[model samples]
Target: MKDEKLLAILRLQKSKAIGDILAKKLIVNVGDVEQIFKEKSAILQNINGIGNHGLKHLFDEKNLKAAEQELNYIKNNNIKYSYFLEDDYPINLQNCIDSPILMFKDGNINFKNDKIISIVGTRNMSSYGRDFCTKIIEDLVQYNPIIVSGFAYGVDICAHKVAIKNNLQTIAVLAHGFEQIYPKVHKKYINQVNENGGFLTEFWSEEQPLRENFLKRNRIVAGISKATIIIESAEKGGSLVTADIANSYNRDVFAVPGRTTDIYSKGCNNLIKNNRATLLTSSEDIVKMLNWDIKESPKKAIQKQLFVDLNENEQKIYDLLSEKGQQLLDVISLECNIPIYQLSSILLQMEMKGITKPLPGKLFELM
Candidate 1:
């Protein structure tokens, strides 16, 4: 990014009222981020949610100074960043509705390989959690999947260490800024993590790891991967929050079932029981559930699975699209005798199953 564009984004990010979600909307609404600054308040206020209150914060002079200071720190430290619109941004995280607009990274971080999955659990992991986590990462080494986790203690550090030992890429998504690392003792593992993969954060250079930041940070952990696996979690904990966010994004979620008596196992147990997560036993489960067994071609694999997995209703809908070609959502609903209300959810399910894909203008087609 140019100096002007970077500064504008920093300033917008520092603004109080405008968050990541609204910042994206403003940029899209105004045609560009820099244009947001050049456009008059009258023009900006015309945007759906932009009002006098929002405009005041959008152009706040105090935030400009803060942004400039932060930008200076970034330049002085030779920090690297990826804008949401840029090609270098993490592809999975890009699909999230509320992903950070800008992310700072360090170390030899390569996102070219798409086999990224997050392993997250409670800070107070037990012996069962430790053994399962280690064995699973070792088992998954051959698949060359990138392991993602928070750099906290217990399960987080265990995942990072095992991934490094297995010679696999492991990304640590931090809750605090680059200047600080929580649990201070975990600092020793930082070099190992960078050597294997690296650190990624949405926070600025000097931000603290406040309580609320961890909750906010959970979203990135959940959204940055193809799936999130919970080795162990208490009934109420951060890992559970990550699982919830993953489900909301319609991503795959896996929880290791354990003895119901274990306190740390409560969350994972409930997750499996409530149908919020699939039961996970070994590395094979992950590979099978995620369809990592690559065969001939993606299209051919999906086609072959259709006959084996599609139900009567799904088959009718799939057959119509296969025969008639791409059609509108309403048209498919009418032709297949499925109501519009029911068709929407069916389409979403088909999308998750890799059977059909949705296109612009409410169009649908076989994958």
Candidate 2:
């Protein structure tokens, strides 16, 4: 089918409530989306919440044309759309009551992966919040899970960066469209994600990042994952929205507790206190909650022999890298006070021994 025609239909379908109603309507109608375009005003008026006023908004020629422009833009930019009927569409999202009608996808995704976790939190995060996020994400990578999050600032970005650094697939669910990225500072990072992973959204490329869209987006983030983790949030932040939605969907919700007096942590603590979320002190808690089997430790003799073979500098680096999965070369050098040239050779030697691997930006991690 011509891409424009397909998108036009999707753009029209976007106006409908995105659940069984729309799914049934599309199934019963079973034709080009443009044909139903004419019936939208009358049809929407009959649906609850979409009164004559809202119906009129649907029929606006300017809006329809703008939506067409968006479709064209998406096609131009090489973005692809996946509808609920598509085989590759996310099954978890499809199971939701208010799943998106169409999603704009920009990278590789194995939607069928058994392990998926949504990490969400406030856009404004504390230092402790960042550290907590880093530690948990590093641990989660061991299971090769897909990490989901909104591409917002603070905790969201931290999770994404960590996922990428650890060679995990991360999906950013945007509140806006593929046409533009909100919080443009993330544009560079988003590009990097697209190159390595991807971004997803229900809105068309031209759709604005309206305040209400974010609330709707939160549902997707919550719905698509097996569990949702809130690292930090203000009492009224949007992370709570994702947690509530996760609860409604019967997905596990985890919150990390912090000092009661800390503003950013109040939301997490409250959720835990109310029994709305499980209190997670470490990644081990989440792994256990999910019933994932932890890998057994290597035999003591094997570990001892492996340690004995390492030279003094190599042993020091190995110890540091084992404690944390990844560390920048500069950080390692500074901590060990080793010359860069010597450190490079040691890192290469360790890599040859299958003890570590290089990551983006000169970082290295234990294998």
Q: Write the per-residue lDDT of candidate 1 for residues 248-273, one digit (tens) a residue.
A: 87789999999989999999999999
Please name the candidate that would achieve the greatest TM-score relative to the true structure: 1
Error of 2 at 282 (Å): 1.6
Evaluate all candidate structures by whole-model CA lDDT and list the values in order: 0.86, 0.77
Looking at model 1, residue 310 earns an lDDT score of 77
Q: Lowest lDDT 10-mer window, candidate 2?
A: 23-32
In model 2, the Cα lDDT at residue 203 comes to 81
Q: Which residue runs does candidate 2 get wrong by more than 4 Å?
A: 1-5, 14-60, 294-367
Model 1 spans with C-alpha error above 4 angstroms: 296-367
Clashing residue pairs for model 1: none
